[model samples]
Target: MTDTGPRVRRIDAPRQDRQDTETYPTVARAVTAARRLVHRHPDRCRLREVGRSRAGRPLFLLSVDDGERTVLAVGGPHPNEPVGLAAAVGLAERVLELPPRPGVGWHVLLCLDPDGAALNEGWLHGPLTPARHYEHFFRPAFHEQPELLPAPDGPLAPMPESRVLTGLIDELRPVLQCSLHGVDFGGAFVQLTRPLPGLAAGFARSVARGGIPLDVDSYDAVGWDSPAPGTYVMPAPGTRWRALPDRPELSTWSYAGRYGGVTAVLEVPMWAIDAVGDARPHPDVRAAVGAAARTLHERIAELTGLLPQVPPHAGVAYGPLLRAIEFNLEVSPLLVEEWLADWSPAPLSVSRVTTARIVAQRLPLRIASMLLRLLADSGGPAADAARARARGIIAASLEGLHRLGIRWVPIGTQVGHQTRAALAAADLLLARR
Candidate 1:
């Protein structure tokens, strides 16, 4: 059969579309692109106000329709994972221009958390390294996170943005949904609320086409099981989340039960480890996991511990930022113990090797670099000395990352992979119907 579905191709956004010299558009830049499409192409696009974020930035839902099966694309659920900000904007431009599929609709939430997104805007442009990105990364506490649910009918933190998304989920009840998320380091991978058979390979293709590999190895898979290469089923949150008393959480996709639909989480990467998918034999898998976990916890502890001793740091609000940093750092110490309590030796995967070598080496620097940035911004002798020490920490971490054979990947390619995947998913979904 000669296929005539709308084909997805890698798009090159005009330089002006970036809103800045940085290849990755900031949340503000994406918002401009989304709004421009709506205003300029009124017949094809409509913009609706979703709600206001906790920070009072207005949230919006852009509905693009020629109409096939409608899909709700979510971006910027977390500030630290900013790739979605770019992906959402790029997808909007393409969808608006593409011949609309009859009965297919795309309702895109340009960004769910502008405030959080702003926190990471520092590294959005350049020095696009793991350390640089994580330095400005900001993820809210679990209870406060919008992805957990957005909002309820009544009082429950009342995340206006999530509330807007919740309303959309209830109103649109999409056939398929995808949340664009990225990681600081590792290969590319996908997370699904439920298995989307044949989707994983599509995700791999998208990565490969974009010149990246499926992040076959990932720390994100610690508690989850992979039913397919590059596809991960996030374990239902229960005890693991509860263990962090202060950080109660719920995954946005968990609401998949409330609203019947397929949800795909496309996790791209800031840097790619080519050999992440390797299945070669190696040392004890359990040991690597344990060691990585310990090293992570120790680094977390060291940074968190240093914050208090630095004379409480001054200039620009550090309280919440520090707590946010501490929250991420605090959560890891218990992860290995939790996983290993029932750990049995399985053939160590290549991921295990990368985890011990690369991820373990670089992950710490992510948080550590952020801590150092805070210290650098702190105006004082003690702060200066701390910043100097932090420079050393970052230097050592980079050395370790290089020793582990990690390399940086282009952000533009990452965005292209993501945008094409969404378009492809939309094409396949509309075709099957």
Candidate 2:
């Protein structure tokens, strides 16, 4: 379907009447259309207020069901990642028109962090500006902005929206969870659980079929060397930490790990989604993407049966690993800048240097840490095997850095800092012992 021009149709009108309108626009427009959709299709869809965002926006959950399996998809965990919200709203509209598979259920949580999203609206519609400016303003980068927004009482905090999400997860216990996100100009790929063997390939096919080119070469866009495709770098220290105890963060993959279900994160590049700029999807690509979505949905449903329950060790080793990542990030600016200037013949993009520091230095340390835990947990030959695996992962990662042509000074002293932090975190993790 291609767009001829902008046209308005009544919400209660037939799907054909609404064909000209884009599903995703500004938040207000999306919410208004969605509310109208629920009202029009009362039999198939129900809208519920899950919680209030920090700014007091009503976070709505649109539940579409055929009565058996439940799938929950969420968007807008980070203020800048708004495409997911658009996609979620679009998917909701599609679900209403099509007949659901017998026993299938879908719940879409639209714009989980409206407060963060509201802060991002200024840049959403217009001449595309530089990403750095948006980063500075939205504070999507962890260290760039205050961890929590200020409130009249105190720090406004992550808000009850996340808490309510956790509660909903506990109650509904969705079999499959997909969080939608968009990469900046570079880095593009759909991410699912790390350990799943063929999931990436399957997802890539779906994306290609959708007419969006797979960004196989753009790994460095998000951090990490070009050699290692799937890895993303950790943000610098004083930036946001990825994992924290007793807090509900938007890193819902960890949440899925905790809940023991299959979780997938679809990272689409904004360019791909806006390929035609307010135009309709290309007919062939739209057919492919729609098919891919359906196929993926079915595959995820099937995988749910095979998914293992959350293991005690699932996130148990993350504390020390997190500390290691943090330590690397803390020392990265000096080491990475020097390495990029001397070793790399080309002047590196500032973002690339920042990203590489996290990927090359910090990530290896984090992996080494998990190995330490594995050694402690396993016995006899299992310990030996764990050590070998850890060493191999670390070696491969280091080799990846060398391949990327990054040379660093003897910052071995940083390792000691990492060690101390890891030890402290490990102690805390063990204290609960």
Candidate 3:
């Protein structure tokens, strides 16, 4: 499965020169910048409200092209993954600057989950570190995630934000949809709704051009078909939907795929780990994965044990954090157990070992962070004691991660890689047609 299509040349997006290179912009800041960009180019760009979030924040759509064929770009599907927001903005700017194509229009959804994104803004003003990120971390639970909600037309009603996306899909029926996404820590990768011959090569090249390591084996890349390293073929709706927690519900990419559009999920990372791309065989695959599973289970037990001692009610402000802890508690251990069960004596790559360790160690920090946030928010003598204990756990986890040798990737670097990958994807779509 080589790239049978034309060779993909490296694409480099213009570097951004913001005051704080390491920090990402808040929802308000990102939206404001997007509006200003649209406002600056009256003829080429048009900004309009598409829908409202659950919390009543307006979801705006920025249309940069009026061509017959359309390319749909969505950002911030997961609020915690804000790299895409900056990428979306950059994409819109690039589209505006380019000479008009014959019939390829571009529509950019700057931020899909504005309410959820707002919750994560605390870390936006950061000397961004692993410790700081988890401390201010927030992610809606499975049921609350817009992209993970049941189908818009299903018996289970979709979230207000998801409905907006469904409606947009119906209206645009785009030729290509780029769902911009990012991870807390990993090398860069892309997930495609289906095979688009040369797209993966372009995406890989884009990652290289941005000086980012290619994540050859991501945690989610396990079950997918890969024509190239760092690129995965996401199973269509009915194929592997059951593998995920929310069965039968289509993600944004799958939803777009239903309309005969190809989706390229540009997944970058905030923290960089070059080891994730190493193809060298791990010395002991079974032992590495087994150890990772043990580490995860141990942490899960310790964290879940603390819950009984603390108050159940942490208020609305900490709901996301609470949900994160609850969801991870139920799911993380099971995932690790399943992985261990499924393991065999195969040629496991170093990247696989790195991914395993990341899943085991870093994931628990998120859970610990959520617990700490919940405890801190409760504000009582007992809660204070619990918070202190959680902080100790977090400190140990952070120290463990430091030993893993992960590096912090600048926000601009992440956005640049995503923007380039997206542009490359768009090119592949046009080339396919």
Candidate 4:
């Protein structure tokens, strides 16, 4: 490829900020921060409305011009992973503060799925405990998730938010597409569509500098097969997506791949700092995982049978809290079934151990949070009855996390891990020129 962009000095990662990621804000707050950046620096950037969400929230694209190859940094590809919004805000601000850099333009879609994000806003401002976070947790079913929606080959029509994102990708044809995704447990890891020399090492160092470990036993660890300490390459398309025929939609990265672009997936955890970049092995991996799965199935069955009594809201939009809970209850057990199908006896890695703890504990609590939200958000005497019943479900998940002794990770350090990965990957792409 020939170069067409202007020349500039090497891009430096922004200095760590103590307060930047301290507050986990709602979608509203993220939108506000994005607007603030544009309004404050009218001479530098423009906040454009790319499209409206399915829920009617106006999706935004904050752009600052420079260079030939645009950089599309998508935040909140999945609603539960809100850390990206923080990283996006920090990145845009840093770009605004410094003079324009060459070979890239900054275009950030700050909140990709506002409806799903709003569903998760309950735990953003936190006491920052595992119990509290788990109790407030909410994630859409695979079919309903923002990125997975508008399934690549399904008969269903594309969601409004999916249309907006796809439109942007087609419009920009970026050089680097960083879809910020983080998990609730385990340690940090990197996923890239194509291997970038030295980028993985830089990523591990970046995360380590923030004092986080590389989760050795990732849920996907069994599949991706780590190339370096914490870095993983997603399996080739031919080798994966073998199941779930209904889920055929192209991911933001997959779609961008057609343009010969690179994707950087940064997965960090909300807690479990002790697992940081850990390499040590623990005993009885398979036994613990089965025990955890069995425990989760038992708890989910109880909830599955109870939620129908609570009554269904007519539309998915009407009762976000109740619907989220109901959907999770149905899907939770199915996940354990998949895990069980793939089980094998092996040395327990931190990622695997952490994964079991989360599945057994936090997964139930995720539903409990939904149940509690149904009561807190709005329910009659029925809400009270549900809350009373929810105590058992809520306790189920907490027991596992507490047993494993997972600690709460601060928002700033989590953001630091994600932001650094993006910078490192960006620099890697630049160096190729």
User: What digit string (tens of lDDT, one per residue) describes model 3 on residues 289-368?
Assistant: 88888888888888888786445667455666677778888888776766587742556889878887888887778888
lDDT of each: 0.68, 0.45, 0.77, 0.69
lDDT of 1 at 211: 69
lDDT of 2 by residue, 1-433 (tens): 1112222111122222122432235567667767888889888888888888645788888887655456677766656655666666666776666555556677888777676666557665644433221321232323212122223344445347656676667766766666666653333454443333223434343343344445453332233223223323223323432222111123444455456555555555443322211123233433333332333233223222212221237335333333333443344343334344442443433333323322443243333433344344454664555556555544554454344333221111111111121122212221221
**Winner by TM-score between candidate 2 and candidate 1:** 1
TM, every model? 0.84, 0.51, 0.91, 0.87
lDDT of 3 at 31: 78
Query: Could you give the candidate ranking by lDDT, starting with the highest?
Result: 3, 4, 1, 2
Q: How well does candidate 1 match the true structure in TM-score terms?
A: 0.84
Best prediction by lDDT: 3
Error of 4 at 109 (Å): 0.7
lDDT of 2: 0.45
lDDT of 4 by residue, 1-433 (tens): 1122333222234466434546776777777888888788887788888999877888889897656787888888778787878877767876786676655687888988888887677777766666666556677755566665555466988778878877887888877888888877767887777776666666666666776767765664446657787777766654552222222225666777777777877787777646434466756667766887788888887776657545444234346566666666766776677557655365656556666657677667777666665455445676567677777777756766666656666778877667666766665565566
Candidate number that wins on TM-score, 1 or 3: 3
